[model samples]
Target: MLKISEVCCEDEYDSMKNYEKTPVLMKRAPFWSGAAVQNAKLVNISMKDFINKYMVLIFYPYDFTIVCPSELIQFSDRFEEFQDLDSELIAVSTDSQYTHLAWTTTPRQNGGLGGMNIPILSDKNHRISKRYGVLDEELGVPHKAIFIIDNKQILRHVSTSDMAISRSVDEVLRVIKACQFVDKYGNVCPMRSPCDDDTCESKNTKDND
Candidate 1:
């Protein structure tokens, strides 16, 4: 497990902390006013369409890379699991749509994803990544980040990993399940008995009638 401190330097850590507490109203997802990706054909994703739907926006450093393919293939193979949870997955990269299309058409046996079912959005201008604060300006590539948005379009969870490490798909599913459980139950489900925690003295208290 990569510790938070290991993932970010001190300055980055401070900036992230400030970003968390800052009271800025985020411009909602699907912020395109007029200019959208060409081809309406390029993944053809629109924010309005995804509103009121659970979404997972995953960013990779770039395409046609070794570690990236492994992760992308696994995610694509398990894409149906996400759909079963009422969530849509969209992968993003700093590469242009042209690159994405070319790669998608290439055969997986030849090291390409090959007719992937999911939409691979192009962040060629880096606008979306900058908005999400995941762009690495120095490298001109996005940090590996995953954003989980609820049906309300609120950003519920954010997880980022270093370029070399791949995130666990199981953990992603667990988070979605946890979020859904909370949404339905109005409280977080305890993984174990409350009495298991020594600090939870209230668990042992008896009601006096």
Candidate 2:
């Protein structure tokens, strides 16, 4: 297991404070993106460089598997909606770029990604997975994890699931919307079930009670 303590250097805050334990959202991590079957290309995308909008990096164990493709496809299906809100969705795994390319070329019925518009990053080194604290100790691979980073380069949210269970893109979108709402209005979003309709704009923040 990757310890958070090992990754921490020095944290900056609005005020100077001494702390033995590292505070979350104060450290920057780098990740590689652009590893898609459509293109066997790799580009270094650092969290430090992203200034505005949000990023959703969903990590799965590997490519060409039972659950990974569906998750990637589902996100890809809803790609433009996220883009309209100024968000980028990235699927990641500890697989080689060649494997990723092959899987994307294969058809979905044939148990491959077929083709996904969103960037499927190849974290062959597992550096981002470990840095984000989602690395599986035994297999030395990433578990099902989704990291939501704000435009300010701060990690805003994290959700993880087991290998057998697939994740919900709707839930991830809801969280991202909530984060955006709060960031914009400075009010917490109401605790409600994710709305299936396009009325996400009507969400209201809870008032003092």
Candidate 3:
């Protein structure tokens, strides 16, 4: 396995690209790693770290953009909701970790993300984005996309949108709930409504102690 390091050589990247196949629904997600800015510090993060828990990868076009901050901050504010559901949200962009940190330090009033609750992953090499097939060849940035990986590392859901559009975090949460419901109960979840306590645990219900 090609573990992500602070400075992955180009040869390593090529080997990874060739070694790993493209991501497919209901299949294991492609393993990836890179530097991430979390809580004002740079850290090495990888898909391996998120194993045994649901991982939500949110790939946005860029930092300091109009719709990007809104989506990021919303996810950050509602991070506990995801945590309650046994999931982690990771925000990724082509921007460098330093840029991610700078944007985090900037206030929302001035169009900054403001100390995000989730780790902001830097896809500066563009390899991770490309491996996921969200990279825009023309724009040199990723399209707004979300990949939900289950505890078993199987990709359960994926959504992609153009740069002009922003994703619905609530909808993502509902989908996650539905995914969990299906996994736990082996029943079909309704399209519009989330699985309630009658069929499965309520979204508000925290994990049992």
Relative to the true structure, candidate 1 reaches a TM of 0.74
For model 1 the local lDDT of residue 178 reads 68
* lDDT of predicted model 1: 0.67
Best by TM-score: 3
lDDT of 3: 0.83
TM-scores, one per candidate: 0.74, 0.74, 0.85
lDDT at 203, model 2: 42
Model 1, 1-209: lDDT tens digits are: 22222222323333443332212322233331112233224545555556566788788998888888788778878989998888877788888888887777778889787766567888887766776778898999889988887776666788888999888887787777767765654445456432234423433342221
Q: State the lDDT of candidate 3 residue by residue for 8-123, as single tens digits.
A: 33455566534323478997676678999999889998887776789999999889888899989999999999999999999999999999999999988998988789999999
The runs of at least 3 residues in candidate 3 whose Cα sits more than 4 Å from the true structure, single-residue gaps closed, are 1-22, 201-209
**Candidate 2: 10-residue stretch with minimal lDDT:** 14-23
Ranking by TM-score: 3, 2, 1
Error of 3 at 21 (Å): 8.9
